[model samples]
Target: MVHITRGLATALLGFAEEAEPESFSTGLGTTPAREFEVDLGCPPETPIFTHFYHPDAGGSVSAVFGMDFSTPAGRTHGRFVSHPQGRLAVAITDDLHATMLVAVPPWGIDELAAFDRRGARQPLEIVEAEPPLETL
Candidate 1:
C-alpha cells in the first residue's frame, strides 16, 4: 500500500486548493477542469454534493467535482478509486468554475461534507466576470 506521510497529505491538499483550473468542463477524465459528484437534481438555489468510489487506478484515488452558480451552495460528488489499504476523507473546495478535492485522513470523510458546505459560505474563488447585456 502506498502510505503518504501526514505531512505529504497536508501539502498535497493545500496544493489542490491553490492550483488553477485549466478547463471548466463538468465531466470526468477531462483535464484542465476538475468535476465532482454534484446533485444535478438541485434547483438554482441550493446545491448538494456526493461521494463516489472507482475501485480502480491500481489503488490510486481519483474524483470529479462540479459547480453551479445558480445554487447558493455548490453541490459536488464523484467516484474515488483508491488502493486496497485505506480510504481517506476528501476536502472539497470551490474553485468557482471547478472544485478541488484534498485528501484528508480516513476519518475526515465523516466531516468532509460538512466542511464542503461551510466552505461555500465564503465567496467563490471566481464569479461571473460580467453581466449579460439587455436588448434595447
Candidate 2:
C-alpha cells in the first residue's frame, strides 16, 4: 500500500483543479477530459482492483488501495497504487467506505505545505506549475 499523506492529498487537488486538461492514450482508449471520482468501500488488509479515470493522464487505470477494518474508522492511513502512477486524496466517509480523488499522471507528490486541517478540510501545499506526466 502507498502512503497517502494529507499534504499529498492537498497538492493533488490543487494540480487537478488548476492544471489545464491534456489527453493521453490508454490500452482501451482515450480517458475522460475531466476529473474522476471513486468510492472505495474496502475492508482493511483486503486487496482489490479499482479503476480511476484521469483527465490529464487520459485513460482509465486500475490500482489497489485498502485498509484494515480493526478500528471504527477502518484505517486512518492507507495507500493507493495506479498504473501511470498517481496519488490518492482520500476522505474517510465511514467505517468501511472512503471517497478518493485520484491525481493521475502529469502529477506527483513533489512537496508539502502547511494549511488548516479543521473540521472536514485537509491541509495542502501549493505548487506554481503542474507536475510532469507519467507514462503507461
Candidate 3:
C-alpha cells in the first residue's frame, strides 16, 4: 500500500491551481523515512516547467514532475528503482472538469505492468493519510 501525505497533497493541489489552463512537470523526492518531498530541481523563484497534453482525454492538461531516479542526484535517496522512471504526475481538465494524481513505481507501477502484460487487474491501494503536524 502507498500513502500520500497531507502536505504533499496540499502542495499538489496548489500546483494544480497555479498551473491551471496549462500543463507542467517537475521532479519529486522523499526523505530517508519515505516522506514525500517535491523536488523542484531549481530555485523556487524560477521553476523549470514542461508542458504535456492528452488529446484523447478530452484535452486534459497535466503536471508531471520528479527526478528520473536514473540520475545521480535522483539516486542519492536510494529508495526507488531506475527503470520505469519514478515520478509524480497530476492531471486536470480544462474548466475544472476533472483531476487526477498519479504516483509512479511503488504507487502505481505494479498495477500498470500487470494490465499491460496480462490484461487487467485491481489497482494498488493508495490511502490518504494525515502526517504528523510537525512534518507539515
Candidate 4:
C-alpha cells in the first residue's frame, strides 16, 4: 500500500529522486516503518520530503474500515476524523481495493496540487475522529 501510494504521490508530484528501496515490515518487534520517510535522498524527486512539505501539519487518517462514507451529502468525513500523528492516510481494508483515508490535511493537499503544476485545488473531505482503540 505504501509503495502504491508513494507511486501515486510521485506521479502526481513529479519526484526527481527514486523512492528509497526498502522492504515492508509489519512485524510486532523492534522494527519500525521506513516507508514513511522515503522523500529525503538526493536528486530531489524525494517522495516523503516533496509531497509532504507539511504532512504532519494535517494529521493521520484512521478508521476501522477504509470506506469513509459520510452521513451528510457533499461533505467529507475526514473533517471529523481526529487527525493524529499530525498527518493523514488513505486507510484501506485487507483487500486493498477500497479507499477511504486519502487522508491529507489542508497544507499537504495544497502542496501536492501545486507540485503537480496543475494549479488545482486540494481535495479533502471532513474526517471525524476514530473511536478509541482499546476497550475498558
Candidate 5:
C-alpha cells in the first residue's frame, strides 16, 4: 500500500490516490469504481517505460497485477477500488506482468533512487519544487 501526495506526481510518473467526491455516489449506498485504462498512449503491446507518467490520476492505492489474465478483456481491465476515509487500494497479483507500482509523496529523490532496479547507480537528478500559486 503506497501512500502519496499530489505534489510528487510528475517525478514518479505515478498518481496519488485520493478520496472521491460525494458527487460520485451511486445512490445505493455504494460507490462505483472509476474505470482506468492503462494506456500509456502507445500501442498496447509496446514496451512501457519502467518509469513514466500515467495518463490519468490514479486511485489511493493502485494495484500492479501480473499479465496472467485468462482473456484479452481481462488484461485490459483496470479500476480504482475506493476505500473509507478517502483512501484507495491497488492489489498486485503478479510481479512478472505488473512490474512497477509507484506512488508519489513528499519523498526525497535520494530515497527513491535507492529503489531503482537499474544497477547503474546513476547520479540522482532533483527537480526544484514549484512555489504554490497565490490565490486571487
Candidate 6:
C-alpha cells in the first residue's frame, strides 16, 4: 500500500487552501529517505490551466489540471491536484489508476478521505509523527 505521512498531507492541504479562488497543479515526489516532496518549480502566478486538442480526442475536457514532472527535484514522483471547491486530489501510480487523499476546507489532516482507483471509498491509514522532506 502507498503510505503518506501526516506532515505531507497537511502541507498539501495547506497549499490548496492558500491557492484558493484558483485551481492549481504541481508535482509530487518522494526523497531518498522515503519522505514526500512537493515541487516548487511552478510559480504561484503561473497560468494554472490550458487547452489542447488531439485527433483521438472525442469529448470535451473541463476542470483539467496538469503539472510538469521534468524537474529533478525528487526521486519517485507524482502530481498534485487542487480544485476550486476543496475537491479531493487524486494521486495516480503506475500500479493503480488513481487514489484520492482529500481534506475539505476547515478540516484537518485527520479527516482526509481515501478512495481506490475505481473511486470506491477506502480506509485512510496515516503514518503518525512522520515529517515530510519539504513543506509549502
Give the number of the best model, judged by lDDT: 6
lDDT of 1: 0.25
lDDT of 4 by residue, 36-109 (tens): 33332223331221111221222333143443222223221111111222333322221121122222233233
lDDT of 5 by residue, 21-106 (tens): 21111000111111114222333343222212232323223334533232323232121122223211222321212222222223
- RMSD of candidate 3 to the truth, in angstroms, is 14.9
Candidates 1 and 2 compared: the better one by lDDT is 2
C-alpha lDDT score of every prediction, in listed order: 0.25, 0.29, 0.28, 0.23, 0.25, 0.45
Poorest stretch of ten by lDDT in candidate 1 = 23-32
Best by TM-score: 6
Query: Candidate 1: where are CA atoms >4 Å away?
Result: 1-45, 51-97, 109-136
Model 2 lDDT per residue over 1-136, tens place: 2223344345344545455353121111111212113323323332221222233242223122243222223322222222233223322321112222234554455422121222132433222222223367
Ranking by TM-score: 6, 3, 5, 1, 2, 4
lDDT of 6: 0.45
Residue clash pairs of candidate 6: none
Candidate 4 is scored at a TM of 0.15
Clashing pairs in 3: 25-64, 26-64, 26-65, 26-66, 27-66, 28-66
TM-score of each model, in listed order: 0.21, 0.20, 0.31, 0.15, 0.21, 0.48
TM-score for candidate 2, please give it: 0.20
Ranking the candidates on lDDT from highest down gives: 6, 2, 3, 1, 5, 4
Clashes of each: 18, 6, 6, 25, 5, 0
Residue 84 local lDDT, model 3:
24
Q: List ranges where model 4 is wrong by over 4 Å.
A: 1-86, 91-97, 105-136
